[model samples]
Target: MTEPLIERCGLRYLHVVGRNFLVWRKLMYASMLGNMADPMIYLVGLGFGLGGFMPAIEGMRYINFLAGGMLCYSAMNSATFEALYSAFSRLKIQRTWEGIMHAPMTAADVVLGEWIWAALKATLSGAAMLIAMYLLGLVHGLRPLAVMPVVLLIGLAFSGLGLIMTALAKSYEFFIFYFTLVITPMMFLSGVFYPRSALPPVVQAIGAVLPLTHGADLARGLTLGTPMAHPLLDVLVLAGYATCGVSVSVLLIRRRLLK
Candidate 1:
């Protein structure tokens, strides 16, 4: 009989995190720059280019509004990329997970550790975006610092989701479907580029169910100092996703590896 997921996991996962951290440290500057650069380009190019023409969004500058979207988007992209490509490399290309499992760990521990490592990386990207926005005067006040926690949650939520996709993926080619069908649509429809209301009602219904929508809503409200109708609901939805991702991915990965 297989071991329970809970029983198979322990503090040893931290060692996995530490291992990834040490590897990351060697190229920290390059990795950090990669995380920050792409989003900064979006913030600067679009904020200055397109935002210059548009009027304030709900009394906030267009760039300020864009900054909020970029914040969550940065976390989402960073976590997804790390969970998918980097994690896949470790799992498939490098066979890192197999080697790790030889130690006193299980598949669940590997999944948990990889998910966490990806989340932490994504959080760093979000922090970079937050600080950049602060320097650019896009976010203000002590309250905006609270966005970091939300950013971390966004990281966990998306990275977990990414792992689910990773578990199902047969090859790196499989990822194109996820990015094209899921990530790209969520990026546009989650109010990252504009208000959710701007989308059609049918589309709004679709976006409402996605994790990114809740995440962007939280990011926008907190960063732009605006009120949200259901902040608690948004947080719950993301937490639910993170939970589901961990649960489902563990089961699937166990099947993939052990069965």
Candidate 2:
């Protein structure tokens, strides 16, 4: 393909997002009942419930901390779920990826389109959750607005990784290992409910390796109105993750589909 056409292929990824709009809209409505409920329970349970005992983080309310972490969680959940479940389904059962490749699009285009869509969906879902948190007064200043781009970067990074995982995944059951071993651990150890400094030295080192740790730190700093430190490092690491993820995902799709 020509350079312009290849670039356009990336743009078609937006159509991939548009195509799924209705289905996600319906799903989001259904998810809202559950998504909204879980955050509310957490905000209440920890913010006011356990918050009575635990002091605020950095002098900010506990709920605010909880809200920021949860917002990041929501975006991560959305991106990872879509990339893993839906992408796997299309690649395996539905053969949607294969079908797309038969069109003017190549395997690279198919993977790129799907990953981009997943990122967009994840961003929308996460943003909705953030707005809900804001309405509840759990969110802090407009600094939290910085979260939008961060959410996009995190989602894009995870979407590529999710694609790579889906490509390698043999069954839905395989996801169990990923969520249990990797995702769950990162969720807790990434300084969600507490500070990373609270952990032991070795564990803190492990936390630093996880992208969620940096993502959470960035989100928390913005939401709580704290000064950003080494902001470029955070961006660079997340960008590195995205680059590796996209490279692997493209390679996998080409190997799987074009072969």
Candidate 3:
């Protein structure tokens, strides 16, 4: 009975994924372009433009330093966009969630499936950035490939949080507040553009609590072959965020859908 139940659940989740995959395939080129463009621009524009005027950081060229951060950031941004904008569209605008719930699947299955799909999409963005960095000579050693799992963790972490926001969102405009107040600040404070150590003590303390900070640290450490001060702690923090975010998102989305 348990095995059959588990298989049923798996099939339900895969059904959701298959639907999303079909939609994604139809717009594959645009999706690829959207995912690859921003990170490449940041890497080339800021890495070269600002790097030319700055000295090497932490014993590597500025572009190299930026590359690792961009990997983590790309995953985060992709997950967040999918969870917030795309998920919200399906849930509210397109009425996709309503249609799905009319099937055997529950709201929990829908939310969980969406979370998994967003994470997978985000991983693609991160992988593209990583490969671009490699081709441009910003990445070194086979160790950098290890950053892929960490990128997925980053995606899961952010996607969960984005789902929470989506649950609370009534209109598309609601996301603007989340982006302005949360995402934008996190982008700057989470050591994407620079080291957290360089920030003031108070800001560093805040950064220490942010999921993106842990992700950026892990990605940078893995990609650059630097020793992480507390690798275990970083993983635990991201895991904690992913776990809690998924739980809360399920509850909130369930409540909203039932209403």
Strongest candidate by lDDT: 1
Q: On residues 17-38, what C-alpha lDDT tens digit does candidate 3 reach at each position?
A: 7889899999999999999999
Clash counts for the predictions, in order = 0, 0, 0
Task: Give the range where candidate 3 is weakest over 10 consecutive residues by summed lDDT.
Answer: 1-10
Write down the lDDT that model 2 would get. Answer: 0.77
Worst 10 residues of 1 by lDDT: 1-10
Q: Please report, as a residue range, the 10-residue window in candidate 2 with the lowest summed lDDT.
A: 1-10
Better of 1 and 3 by lDDT: 1
What is candidate 1's TM-score against the reference?
0.97
Query: Model 1 lDDT vs. the true structure?
Result: 0.90
Best by TM-score: 1
Best-to-worst ranking by lDDT: 1, 3, 2
lDDT of 3 at 99: 98
Model 3 bad stretches (over 4 Å): 1-11
Give the per-residue lDDT of model 2 (tens digit) for 152-236.
8888888888888888888899888889988889888888888778899999999987877777778777766767677778878
Task: Flag clash pairs in model 1.
Answer: none
lDDT of 3: 0.89
